[model samples]
Target chain A: MKKILVAAFMVLLGASWANAAGTAAGTQIQNSLTLDYEVGGINQTDINADDGNGFLVDNKNDVLVTTADVASVKVTPGSTAQVLTFTVKNEGNKVQDFILSVSDAGAAFSLTDNFNATSQSIFVESGTTPGYQSGEDTETYIDELAADGEKTVYVVASIPASQVNGDASIITLTAQVATGGTASSQGSATVNDTGADAEDTEQIVWADSAGETDAVEDGKHSDASAYEVQSASLTVTKGSCVIWDPANEGTNPKRIPGAVVRYTIQVANAAGAQDATSVVATDVLPGTVTYGVGGSGLTQIARVVTEVCSCTSPGTANTGNVSESTGTVTATYESPISASETQCAYFDVTIN
Target chain B: MKKGFLSILLIFAFSSIVYADVSIKSQSLQEKIINKQTKWVKATKVIPGTKIRYINTMSNNGTVMAQNLVITNAIPKHMLYVDKSAKCDGVCSITYSVDGKAFDVPAKLFVTENGKKRVAKALEYKAIRWIVQTLDANQSSSVQFDATLE
Candidate 1:
């Protein structure tokens, strides 16, 4: 049967020439020759020859990017969007089209990029779900990208409610090398096929390699990626002391006129910050003092107390999460105070 | 039909007088560096790893001696041959082929892989030959090789 259909069409033409990355940009490469000779006893007829137009195959363009983040992304200063991931890769031989852009100006890893990240877009990773997908990645640039293809890019910024705790920003992303067969637009940039050699036109050979800010062969590349920030820093404080004074009935104690006063307020939170939730702590009784006298409503003390309302082991005092009404004085703490934690909130008054 | 159109015009006038006794040419170059010296030129376009070369020549125009000759070539299909580069000038003999229909000699080719047997590679050749053994009558020779483009 036609040699088993020509050996199954040469195994489907060697599997589409092993998937491609090199021989495709206009591919002509005809080269012929054949000859044969004879004469003494006679037998002449086989010449062939070539060089009749056959050259093409050019375009090596290249593109790389990389930075699918392996660290520094822990952001949270008001956070929104905030992605980073990068990948690009089309180390070209043909099918291209890239053009994406983003830049926090550069440099940042052990951090020092101080702040600047608000609405910084650039998407293109709609692989149907594989990271950055604010509702299915919106596709901002790299369209065709084949030959050794790669694509997974994103940047999506917005972390700025005044940015704190280690601040940082970085970003970068780049990509450039365009012109591959229009399909949604952008295609144009690709430039570096200068003079001579036009054996049938197929030019463009930049070969990319510099990245981090792009340069060598300049078809653009870049990488970087940072962010940092991590919120929650709290601190408060507030001391007060004159514990009991029936006219110095405990030695040096005197705020006079029925003395008794005691109040503390600490709070803390800050050993690398983040984790200060719920904490309340209020206190407004000063019409010459009188809200509960020697402890009555708020006494949760024991955060390693530093002496002001004195409480070495005095934790339980009708702790209904503490509260007093018109003369104020409230304390809440529904848990979270972590990170180098401190939390005091004491209360005791009677002076007028 | 006019005696079959006069035997197709005498077999196209006896194969145009036996194809005027042997000739051939072919070229395709590439090397290029220019002002810093390197120059080879002529290949109008080629990038995926470039190399090229090819050459060919062949002559011998009439009055006798042209024996055995041969030549061939093929290769081009995203290219790749280069190992030992293939040359040919005075005495001739060269050979190779993978499957552009059997040629031989690099200790008789081989190729099978996975099913074992190996030995082919010069990027799996595909065709080259050469032969010669005589040309005389005004003579000419050439034959070159190279390849790479993949």
Candidate 2:
């Protein structure tokens, strides 16, 4: 009879050790003690008593937010769609929803925060695809995020045209704990359970530590990321060299009457994320000089100019439009002068 | 054989006349922030990961001393026993059980994992037993163990 009872107790012990996030709230941990003793060398009956009602497990609410980008996302000025990614993880012991928001007031990256991005929008990454997709990841706020579950969130914005190269816009993503259970909808923000502890019901407690902008136990967390402007910087310079003359042709040509001079206008852009487009260079010839002896008097080209104002390489000819009217030469280079590229406009004139 | 059985029944009845009465009672406690200080109070607001202390008091209420007093307690469900937290106020030997059927010292408890037998962790302990040599009349002793809610 005693062996059967002992075996039953062993079975109960094995069932209670199942792994979980924690014991569910309001679970009664009933326990009793069994005492066996012998008096005067005689075995006595066992004694047992009921321990006081066991305590209930309270609610633990915690969350973590971290920026997924190692560095600020590079964007060009006037970029329509730029993204900064973050991760929101539910560190609590139960399911929860998170209300998400983005703010321009945040910690800056290595670059100075000088501008604010426009049309800022938040998105929750869909599990179907990774990273930010314009039309794919459309969910704004997190819903029904399970314990230890994390979702990638994107802060999408547009870079204004006025924002120049090296300008940065910092964006902060904040997630506030909210009531969970419903799907496809935003839940109300959760307040920590307060007042006297109730043994029958699970009480909510804030267990999260501090994040970038949130205090400890505040049921919310925040992290910051940035978008830095990486626009093209273009510079233009014009130089002229004597080409031919009646007396000293192509050799130490003088700035005298009938001396022909070749003019070169160079437009160079530094290596950057954007390209300069619709580049037009114009030079007004003096009354002492006339348009080139050749037809049209203008030829648009491109070259790698190493020394300042020095043009030597016969670069590939550009498909730009060139026109000369009343001794003034205008050349519109091919559209979109790419980064780390130099384009030059060449025209010749004769001293009259 | 009938006469021998009758004599044994009489001896059992005589021993019952000089019996020792033993009683057991249990209590559960949890830590709470009361006023400005943290104190161990009756578990009122319990939650996951809360550390609970289960205490069992054993007392001898009769005129004779209770010999070989053994107190056994099952670690509560949904809880993990804390290592080295079992204690007894009197001179006693304490052992643990993983399955509640086989009790052994902490060093002797073993569990099989991946076809290999390894020493059981404190969290795997399911039951605790404490044996005291004797409990004198009108004397009470308590045994306690701490566990954290899973």
Candidate 3:
């Protein structure tokens, strides 16, 4: 009886030990085992409880993403201080700083002729500013842009009056991760060096796990936008005033047939940047009026006067003659008149 | 003894039938930018600055429901995972890893900087994992996330 009782006790202890071991093994399998399911060679999927194999994960460091809103601009000639707005978006995962610049497109502008295009003077301003200053401020420092954040920038270009029509310039905006560097002197009023003030300094977050240094991957992204200069419109107008008499100048001029009349042709340019070259004015006498050369029956006018009227001083007058064959009077100006400048030509005719 | 052996064989066969027939399929997509708007396109060849999305579908064809199904994916090289973009259809728990070895919630994941621990940012995440509590038989579920090519 005693031997049988001891054997039974041993059996119970053995079962308990076996149960404990099985429970521990099952827990281990659940925690660390990679479970794979295969259904009759048709479907297969695997899952790793620990970091072994299932999905591939990689950390991206030094990812600097930047883009400009406006790709190009067209500026009309005579447009004073036109503003080209661009929104610089920081799609990177960190805060970054950017510098702005404007340069002539050069070969990129695709100019066949030596246009002598004037370099555009540009100024940088934030979105809130009312006006842009024309000094050395061109760089913009973005203090802290969270991931997927964007800021609007205004590029104010002072289009030179000398800029010809169809001229083009390109503006390039480059963004660089402001890790550590001396602040540029030409930065905007709101932009300053990263470490200029101790209290205002932003913390630099490293991109890697070891944290030995910030992972600097492609930290600079640049985009260029082209701006074309539009052409200026030019126009001319002409009129005549009757002179009652050249010898006896009357206060009130009348439209009498025998009265000596002075034909005045005024050539004026519209408000534009282009100059009108080789301006010439011609007038033909009617059958009812005679050339003031003291003759009748299609006689020629001896001379006519043409001068620049809008200059500071009276321009030199040139003498022109009327053709007897065609009964036409012609006057040519020597120099080209710029926009808003006028030239005048006058000749006398007597009514029959 | 022969009868007992037959009963054990029968139980083993029944368990095998219950655990079989789960299928998983995966696909990749890219986002195209047109006129300042975003449209998704199927990814064949990816380029830098492109946003990519990965979709994984898990289907159960067995007669018994699947329990405690977990899906995990590694962030591909030259890609930055978008923050908080991972999702699943059923009740699940999502977690992220910075070094791919260890995983934790986004707020709890930490990285050492200047000899101090700081919460890891979204771009620092290297991997994502999702745990599904249960999937009914003959039903399917999906998980997805977005990343940007570096």
Candidate 4:
């Protein structure tokens, strides 16, 4: 009987040891990497979070460390041309760099207001330094992007208020690293305010305005940055643009949600000037366009008729749902715009 | 009688199996290929006066996103342009479009600081430079130029 008891005790001890070992491991396997997104007080529109734990969203923007992060863009037409805005926060390990660009996809869009397609280059980044130039133009940066940095750019597109129907456009933007750079932080979202309200279009005829245009992008340099302005901050003040008119809109305009309808875009300074010297009217097709007749105040830098926004702004996509073919986008500007001032754009599209 | 019953059961099983082969359903998510791009090689545009400067754009198809993207070009000559590149200095670079516009910039030419033909890398096409972006889903990006064309 004593020998039997001893054997039973030994068995019990062995079982207990096995149970303890399993408890130490808990549920998930040990020594494995897992990613989680962070939460709390995070803005769904603009939030910083790593997946929970070490998955860190840099500034904690709830964004994953992976390169597939994306952001949304919003373009609203105020009294001037239109107000295009978006916010970006650092959501990665290393310092981040951002670039925003756009292109005309095709006839997937139409203008709500009549605009000029002449004498313009939409300054799309942020119209100035400390801010991304917000117009339809070009600028480079040399500064190092610290991890989790955040910034926003606003573009003020100008059009001569003479543009009509059948004008389509697309825009693309890129965000990346300022250092060894990869398209990792590459994210994209689109905004549109094109075309007129049904009643407004039918009521007003020939109340046209010229369309505007612009571009954006980001990259890295091993040596010193070859750009003039690496980092930018935009400061905005009140300057009324020419009012938008629903009348005289395009004869046939594409229908897109949130498209930029009639807008009055204006800027004090567009170029690198502190006093706000360079400002031009620009247009972007919500999609494809067909009827195109070049204008003087605008330059047809791109006559893309494909379904996607053909302009190569950095991101995961060119034009999301834009039908890249069959339409036109126009841009215009103001040197003085007071009868005495003269402006000339490159040319217009004669859709093939 | 028992043997006959076993034969009938066997036959029924065989027939069912044959029917399954004839009526199996297939599941697949198929999207039509729009613009398809083939192979593409890019060189850093660095040469100052080369009239024919290279521009970086999407490969082959104007709209289709590239799949199984590959880089057949060599280093420096076949790499993205990077200043102080540890691998290929002066030879590595990239290009970008202004507002997505397809404009021709200046040409790029790679020259070793030591003034020696880089036989070590065996880069292709005079060994300028290039890079490959592993795009996801419908992702896209751009390459910047170093030199303008003639």
Candidate 5:
């Protein structure tokens, strides 16, 4: 009876130890079992024996994971080609092969506001362990990335020449792990056989398990940058010409009292990609000069030329007023000056 | 406890005695031409060589009058001071400084030119000061000067 009871107790303890051996993925589960036995008679000494003490075993499974990141960039409109960079890391316990793709965020290419991707494929850096050889690989292939390994990639893009101010473009990069044949397989496989004597090929089968063995999770990252157009460089030039004799017209064209001096103000936009808005030209005649006047002390005025003198069509005429007390003259442009365009204004004052 | 309460009361009384109500406002002006008439227009944007007028208005809003009030303004960079353009309405003394440190009348202000002491040119004036003897409560006064952008 004692021997039977000891055998039953050992079996129960083995079952309990097996139940506590299950553990989370990616970690080893080590366990051991020990047994002690004793035999004795009521009047005699006891004999003891210990076996299977400190005998340990461990088990684990692989896990698959990945992540990606992209860096933002800044460039000016009409600038040369620029680079967009990204980093893809593999956090799984096995090697992974990643394929790359780049696309704009939904807006079709247009002349007013858009960016152009110069290359359809991404290029990986060279000399990286398990990385693709430079210049030989066109597609963004990782070849082999060890566990917790990462690779950097570069994509070239250009800003359209006609891109307007404050224009922006968002570029998304996606990396997907390749899976298929023996070369491209995902997760681990299991096999099961019911017959006692089965063929070697029939005994082994693939089990489609999802976690670490041959498994891969796709990674996606996106970044955007804006093209800032600079302000136009507007230059103003003023020139003065004197008219000494009013009645004689061409007589005495030098500075003199009671002479009328005509002034020309030219405003030009120097930048080819920018335009000037709300442009106005003003000039305050010095204390020595007074506003030209006609009979009965009525003030005289001048008109601004709307178009360039070289143009064949007559330019629009803008009128300017003179202040008798302050000797100020002003002319406001009716339209904004386009890039690389020039506008002029004319006014006249009398020498005090 | 009584001594601490009295200290708090004394601090409040000192703060009230030190506080005074006075305000200063400033603006820039430019001459505008309209229908052959010169009008003073608020200067919003000025270009090189444009003449700008700066007016500073001081007001005493407190119940007690303000005494020995002095107002000073430094000439802005890239600007040339117009000669004899500073003006004030009250019985005040106006002074000019070439270095923004020493102040005196225009005739007395001097600068070392070529190792010789000479009267500073109007364009060399760096700062302006106005000294008012007294300003009655609820009264306001204005000071103005003209400068040309270089």
Candidate 6:
């Protein structure tokens, strides 16, 4: 019986030891397993924050993002069009939120973006977008996007295509997020005559930028001659093998490429007459390109100078009767943004 | 015969296109904008032992050329006593002046076609040759002279 008692004591001790050891082992396993702090070089996993949408930006000094885009806009030339696009995400860890805005101070103040439709589009200058600036645009808010949130704002700009004569502006897109928001990344878009190829009857009115130059040629194109004044237009394209000769001297019609290149053109005056009003010269340079200097006299080749006059003022700078022969009336033009190679610029000389 | 017909068709198509195409005309003034020299003249300042030069610039604001006309200038008498020059052929003429004074100046100036001058003072001398020339409408000539002042 005593031996039985001894065995019982040993069994109890063994049971206790086993329980203690098993508990220790379970605790060790729990400590050994942990949540990984990093994935794909992103440390956000460490914080394990909300807002499943999170991004890691390599460049923290300059980060310009288009938080929102105005899909619809109404534009008219010689007027102000302000579109709202915000730079949302600032990626730095700093608490203070930098202001986001745009301006055309660095770029030419005259050439602002024209949305063309009634819903005018705003032009942005440097800050986060093309029209580089640091100040807040009108109606711009959100000094600091919350660490995980974004700032929303709009861009407002004034561009008068007519009075300004080649008016344009740019949209500078920028973002000021919490951590090292921008590293050196800013975005920009060029402003142009939005109504360049409008099909509306009023389209010709906007083309008034031609002034009085085109008026006389339109009348002369009515007459018939050996080389009937066929349709005429000024156009441009990259240099071609047959025509791109810089050495060929003077306004080679083949249309050389430039932010502003000169284009000159002539057509057979088949039914050329003083009354012909279709003769036209139009300049079609890429809207992306701009003149290096003001009044550079570099314009589209297809543009015809127009002369408009009231009873008071002398005919506009280029206006004349069909019979009149102006030095370069209706012949010179500066190019605007062109759509395609065919639309590059062409005049249809209709034989009456 | 087939090849000939094809060639004729191609030519017709090309001619039609060319007829309607507005193009650069070789006769256009914009096309003639080559780096062509328009005119030149001598300096007005005369000095010895200095590099002499005529700073002549190309026409209109360095953008376009000025055309046609004539002008006359006389070498200062103080510099060229009785220099051999040319008579005005309705184009150019030159004069002389020993000193840059009104009375001592020559009554008439001579013209230099291929202007040539010799410095009486020194081989290294500068003479500001006073010059005059007429430019046709829309034409220009910018002539300047660099020399040490006497």
Candidate 3 per-residue lDDT, tens place, A312-342, comes to: 1233455433233366767664456566666
Per-model TM-score versus the true fold:
0.39, 0.81, 0.35, 0.19, 0.30, 0.19
**Which candidate would rank higher by TM-score, 2 or 3?**
2
For the second chain of model 1, what is the TM-score against the true structure's chain B? Answer: 0.35
Model 1 lDDT per residue over A1-352, tens place: 0010000001111212323567767666777667766677465667777777657777788888888788878888888898888898887777788999997777757678988889999988888888987888998998888888888898888898888887889888899889988777778998897776666787888878898887889888888889898777888877777666776655687888776666767667789877877778777777887766543233323232322234323354322265679998787654677777766666667777
Report clash pairs, candidate 3.
A55-B73, A55-B74, A56-B74, A56-B75, A57-B74, A57-B75
Error of 1 at A31 (Å): 4.1
Off by over 4 Å in 3: A1-48, A52-82, A106-127, A130-139, A156-161, A177-220, A226-352, B1-150
Q: List residue ranges in candidate 4 displaced over 4 A.
A: A1-81, A106-143, A165-170, A180-352, B1-150
For model 1, how big is the CA root-mean-square deviation? 16.2
Per-prediction interface RMSD? Answer: 8.8, 3.0, 21.0, 31.8, 46.7, 50.5
Q: Comparing candidate 2 with candidate 4, which one achieves the higher lDDT?
A: 2
* Candidate 4 displacement at residue A151 in angstroms: 1.8
Candidate with the larger TM-score of 2 and 4: 2
Best by lDDT: 2
Best by DockQ: 2
Candidate 5: tens digits of C-alpha lDDT, residues A1-352:
2121111111112211211112111221111111111112111111221121211111111222221222235555566545555566543323445565566642222223355544344666554443434454344455555434676765556666675544556554555543212443332222222234221111211111232112222122232322234445677877777654345444655566666776777777775636666777768779887766322132343555655532212245654222224566776754567777777776667677
Candidate 1, superposed: residue stretches over 4 Å from native: A1-34, A39-59, A72-100, A103-172, A178-188, A191-228, A233-352, B1-71, B74-78, B81-127, B130-148
Number of backbone-clashing residue pairs for each candidate, in the order shown: 1, 6, 6, 181, 8, 137
Model 3 lDDT tens row, B29-93: 66666599986655533323446677777788877777666565667544578988999996889
The 10-residue segment with the lowest total lDDT in model 3 chain A: A1-10
* The best candidate in terms of TM-score: 2
Relative to the true structure, how large is the alpha-carbon lDDT of every model?
A: 0.75, 0.77, 0.50, 0.24, 0.51, 0.26
True contacts kept of each: 0.71, 0.79, 0.01, 0.00, 0.00, 0.00
lDDT of 4 by residue, B1-150 (tens): 999999999998776543100001111111222367432222111111111122222222222222222111111111222222212112323322121122112232323548774322211122222333332223333322222111
lDDT, candidate 3, equals: 0.50
